[model samples]
Target chain A: QQQVKQSPQSLIVQKGGISIINCAYENTAFDYFPWYQQFPGKGPALLIAIRPDVSEKKEGRFTISFNKSAKQFSLHIMDSQPGDSATYFCAASMEASYDKVIFGPGTSLSVIP
Target chain B: DAGITQSPRHKVTETGTPVTLRCHQTENHRYMYWYRQDPGHGLRLIHYSYGVKDTDKGEVSDGYSVSRSKTEDFLLTLESATSSQTSVYFCAISRVTRGEQYFGPGTRLTVT
Candidate 1:
């Protein structure tokens, strides 16, 4: 069973446009949600993260909007740049599980100039 | 960037052979994880260790085994490599269970 699910296996946006990727989870126990970005042939790096205590978090042009009640979260990139094109993964974890994360399928984003 | 390194960055092996990938970290993190990345499937946990000589299976532990005998070293072994086991393997570490994880560059394995 895929406890965490993500939509739009792929996406494309023009430079300076907004890019969005959505994710959902069925496990209510999940309390920690994080997003990771990966470039070709490299490891995925932490882009941003959010806890259930907050409805939204912003870091630079990256923003994570979380809806705990809806069991969903989305990543919004303002002013998307060609360099921002890469794969994004959304993950969820809880303290009960020792914080072992369950990652979503992932979304491939392409920013064209 | 996390002082994590994976050895044998690329390998080609025959089916039914045995293979091992190593993950080494210098951050002295308390938790280490082994994950395999495949097309369409994303990254799936194979195993994880919280301390030396202590390890646990993850969702896809079949056909694989792991050992963590030192604070900086974690090993993933394929008892018998299979074609399906060919994928990019990644190692991740975190200072605490709930903290952000730092991932290794990844190792790509191909089985014939």
Candidate 2:
């Protein structure tokens, strides 16, 4: 079973437009939600993360909106640029000792300049 | 960004041959994980270790094995490599007090 599901396997957006990627989780026990960005031939790096207690988190051009009741979370990139093009993965981890994170299939986003 | 490294960045082996990939971290993180990435499929966890000599299997641990004898080293071994096992493998390390993990450059393994 896929613990986390992501939609829109691929997406393209104008340079100045907003790029959105959505994810949903089945395990309600998950408290930490994080989004990772990975470029070709590179390992994934943490972009933004949010706790269930907060509804939204914004770090510069990246934003993460969380919904506890809906068990859903989405990533929004403002004023997308070609540099922002990469594969994004959404992950969930419960507040436990191990904190084993389960990741989504991932969404490939491209920003055309 | 952490000091994580995977040795033998690229390797090719024949079917039925044993292959081992090494992951080394300089930060001495307590938590280390091994995952395999393939086309269409996202990263799938193979194994993870919470502490030296403490390890557990993950979703795709059937044909893989891991060992962590020290805090900074983890090894993933394929008893008998198969063509289906060809993929990019990543190693990640995270400290107990840290929320985010740091991944190594990755190892590209191919079995023909």
> Against the true structure, whose DockQ is highest?
1
Model 2: which docking level applies? medium
Local distance difference test, per candidate? 0.91, 0.88
What tens digits encode model 1's per-residue C-alpha lDDT throughout A1-113? 34789988999999999999999998887878999999999999989999999999999999999998899999999999999999999998885664369898999999999
lDDT of predicted model 2:
0.88
Top TM-score model: 1
Instruction: Kindly report the root-mean-square deviation of model 1 from the true structure over all alpha carbons.
Output: 1.1
Give the per-residue lDDT digits (tens) of candidate 2, residues B1-112.
Answer: 7899999999999999999999999987888999899877788889989999999998899889989998889999999999999999999987652346678989999999
Name model 2 segments beyond 4 Å from true. A97-99, B97-99
Candidate 1 wrong stretches, greater than 4 Å: B97-99
Residue B46 of model 2, lDDT score: 92
For every model shown, the clashing-pair count is 0, 0
lDDT tens string, model 1, B72-96?
9999999999999999999999765
DockQ for each of the predicted structures, in order? 0.64, 0.57
Roughly what TM-score does model 2 have, to 2 decimal places? 0.96
